[model samples]
Target: MDVLITGANRGIGAGLVAGYRARGAAVIAAARSGGDVALDVTDAACVAAMARALAGRAIGLLVCNAGVYVDKGERLEDGFAPALWAETFAVNVTGVFLTVQALLPNLSLAEAPKIAIVSSQMGSNMRANGGSYAYRASKAAATNLGRNLAKDLAPRGIAVGIYHPGWVRTDMGGAGADIALEESVAGLMARFDALDMARTGEFLAWDGREFPF
Candidate 1:
């Protein structure tokens, strides 16, 4: 299988690249810098070029993992700057849409292509605990994008699933987070394997539990 993962320079994205390759899949690790494929998901021209580069190859899986969390400690009164919101949404929301849009043709060539969007439980309205407004809103948008894409792509034999990879010990998740990077990667791989048309558009956690929208 040909699997492409974005934001693969570090953290869960990097672990996923290693895990998928160990399973013998041809993995394309794409990052803003220092990856098998040089890609800045926020750049439309870069995304288009990537699509052209992989012109005829079939992509069995497309992992929209690129994201940002700039509002980590921003207070509601004066924290979430306008630029921060724009930057976060550009990468976390718009980037996912552009990548999927550019790669639709490649996904269509596969027998059963799947799209795995690495959203967060923090995005869930039911789980909202306040703070990180920009990150939360962007993730919610990402999940929504994945859900809609699942509907539009189902007829093309593509399955789209939004996932919360758990509170993993990564740069974004922090060292005090709940799980290790390997654990998150393992569970997420299983989730990806189980994805099909019947389960498309579902928001799930790394452990296979349903995530409330």
Candidate 2:
């Protein structure tokens, strides 16, 4: 199997890439700074270029995991500064949309094509507690984006889903979160492998439970 992961330098994205690589899957990792797949998700041209370069190669798993927070500790107005919100959404939302759209040609060849967008519980309106307005709004959009993509792409046999990795102890999640990055990533990847057409368009937790949209 072949896998493509975005924002794969540290934390969940990087760990997931490592896990998949350990399982012997050919991996293509993307990041703004650098990684195995040095493409930036924010750049449509870059994603398109990378996808074209891969051509007819099959990508069994496509993890649209790249995301950012202006700062987890501050209020969105300052933490996700007005200026930064644009870039953040460009990376966190539009990036995933464009990357997946661009990679469709390459993804079509996979025997079991699966697409996962890393979302957050902050995006959950049903259980919202407030704060991080920018991050929450952008992810809410991504969650729905995954749902729409799942429905549109199901006829082609590709399964698309969104997941909340919980408050994983990553740089963005900070050191205080209750869950470890390894635990969250492991559970999410396991769920990804077990998904099928019936589960498409769903919002699920890392531990394999479904969440209301």
Candidate 3:
């Protein structure tokens, strides 16, 4: 199996790459700044270039793991700037769409393809907390995007699933978060492994429970 993971330089993304490789899958690790493949998902030209480079390769899995949480510590009164919202959405929401759009051809080449979107529980309407508005909104959008893509891609033999990787201890998740990187990655790979057309469009957690939309 061939897997392509974005933002694979560190954190959950990096762990996914390592775990997949250990299982004997050909892993293509992509990152915005640096990795096996240089891909800035926010940049359409960069994503297009990446697609061109991997034109003939079949990607069994595409993990849209690249995202941003710029509103982590921002105050509601003074910290949520307009530019910050734009910046966050560009990478967190728009980036996911662009990556999927560009890689559709590669996915189609495979007999069965799956797209794993690294969304968050923050996106869940039922689990809405007060802080990190921009992050939450972008994640919600990403989740919705995955749901819609699932509807559109299933007929083409591509399954799309949105997942929350738990409150992991990464640069984005913080040290005080609920789980370790290893735990989150292990759960996520299992979730990815279980994804199929029958379960497409489902919002699920890394631990296999269905997440509330």
Candidate 4:
């Protein structure tokens, strides 16, 4: 299977690249820098160029994993700047849409293409805590994008699933996070493998539990 993962230079994205490669899948690790393919998801031209580079290849899986948490510790009083919101949404939400749009043709060539969006539990309305407003809102938008794409692409034999990869110990998740990177990667791979038309548009966790919207 040909799998392409964005933001694959580090953290969960890097682990996913290794995991898929270990399974013998033809993995295209795409990142803004230092990856198999140079792609900045926020840049439409870059995304288009990447698509052109892989013109005739069938992509069995497209992982929209590129995202930012710029407002991680911003204060409610004076934090969450306008620029931060724009940057976060550009990468977390718009980036996903652009990548999917640019790669639709490649995905259609596959027998059963799947799109895995690495959203977050913090995006869930039911699980809304407090801080990281921009990150939370962007993730929610990403999940919504994935859900709508699932409905639109079902006829094309493409399944889309939104996932929360758990509180993994990565730069984004922090060292005090709940699970190790390997554990999260293993569970996420299983989730991606289990995705199909019947389960499309569902919000799920790394461990396979349903995540409330």
Candidate 2 similarity to native, TM-score: 0.94
The digit string of per-residue lDDT tens for model 1 on 34-84 reads 898889999999999999999999999999998889899999997888999
* lDDT (Cα, tens digit) per residue for candidate 2, span 9-108: 8899888988888888898887876677668878777888787788888888899999988745676444667777797789889999998998887679
Residue 77's lDDT within candidate 2 is: 47
Against the true structure, candidate 1 reaches a TM-score of 0.99
lDDT (10s digit) by residue, model 4, range 82-173: 99999999999999999999999999999889999999999999988999999999999999999999999998889999999999999988
Off by over 4 Å in 2: 76-80
Error of 4 at 12 (Å): 0.4
Residue 184 in model 3: lDDT = 94
What TM value does model 3 have? 0.98
Report the error of model 3 at residue 36, Å: 1.2
Better of 3 and 4 by lDDT: 4
- Residues 71-163 of candidate 3: C-alpha lDDT, one tens digit per residue: 888998889999999999999999999999999999999978999999999999998978999999999999999999999897898999999
Candidate that beats the other on TM-score, 2 or 3, i.e. the better one: 3
The total number of steric clashes, by the backbone 3 Å criterion, in model 1 comes to: 0
lDDT winner, 1 or 4:
4
